[model samples]
Target: MKKIALLVLVLFCGTSNAQKKKKSTTNPIVAVIITKTENLTAEVIKPNFYIFRNENSIKKDTLLLKAFSSSITPTDCVIKKFVTKSTPLYYVSWTEKMNSETKLKKETIVVTNVQIWNPATKMQVFSNTQTSTNIKEQVFLDKNKTASETQERNRNEGYNFTLLPTGDFTLKNKAVESKYNLNTVTMKYELPQKSADVSKSSKKKKK
Candidate 1:
């Protein structure tokens, strides 16, 4: 009788551990892509943006798993195998460029892209891109033309985009979350600065 009790207790403990592990592993993970730029003045804002999106300064990396929680389970049983259910995974990405290039070519504007994925379903839930523009006002520049007026007149704008995946997915009986944490690989690089225009280049050559 004692041996039977011991076996039952061990089974119960194993089940509990398995459930805990499953819950912890089911949280979604995020991935990110970042980009940055330098010396983005009003005269060269477009060029800077082009450079940011271009090969050099663009960076891509997986997001660090911050905080996540698994779905609620309200039942307890010994030796009851709980098949893993599909869960949405969130991916966050961002980029930073000179927000107010003309205002402060030295500053940066940050942009982010987020996506939701579910391996169990083999589908994406949602995807979105967000941009944070850090507009810095220069009192010196404001003296010539009011900062507010310049900001209003300037056509430079900030925006965000989002999308939801369409289609259906099926879950399998073998679906199980791995306890081993996953990691994101990051790629960091710098954008290439544009060279002087023909007129400027010719002047340097003449000098």
Candidate 2:
């Protein structure tokens, strides 16, 4: 009787260990939500969103046991456009406030940041903050503008980006027509900067 009991105990232990290992082997799935700044939504982001899953920025960066959600999720972002339909390219931009010394008082309106967020990596890849060269004449008015007025009027001059699968995209100052060129730009590279350590999952976005 004692010998029989020992054999059963060994087998039970082995089965338990196997089950634990299988649970750990399960892959992890993350949620990704890309926000579009109003006007660009129809042309840039919404048009080809299905392609995003194939993008290296979205695919290669994350691990998946499984993730499930709406095909795409939408969020609001504040972006001001200087020209409408002048160029076929679409872009999203965000700005930071800075106090500029003026004769009458201080002023604010310089966009110092633009970036894309990867839910899988929980990392915000930043754009070239040095977009001074690309700001087109009409994109943002610079001539004959006051300090405060110049800061507010000059939207396109501050920053711009082109979304690419590699995630290492920079824009040419010249405008070009491309479906993937729709990019997310922010005045701060860190979106939801407060949540540095949090890794987002599809469940969170659904909520």
Point to the candidate with the largest lDDT: 2
Alpha-carbon lDDT, every model = 0.33, 0.38
| TM-score against truth, every candidate | 0.24, 0.24
Q: How many clashes in candidate 2? A: 4
lDDT of 1 by residue, 22-118 (tens): 9998945432212222311111121121111123433322222122123211111111111112233433233333333553333444445443333
For candidate 2, write residues 1-207 as lDDT tens digits. Answer: 999999999999999999999999996654334442332221123223211223433333221211223342323323322321122222234333444554534444343444343333444433444223222122234565533332223334533555454323444444532222223442222334333234355447779
Q: In terms of TM-score, how similar is model 1 to the real structure?
A: 0.24
lDDT of candidate 2 at residue 194, scale 0 to 100: 32
- Alpha carbon lDDT of residue 158, candidate 2? 32
Angstrom error at residue 42, model 1: 34
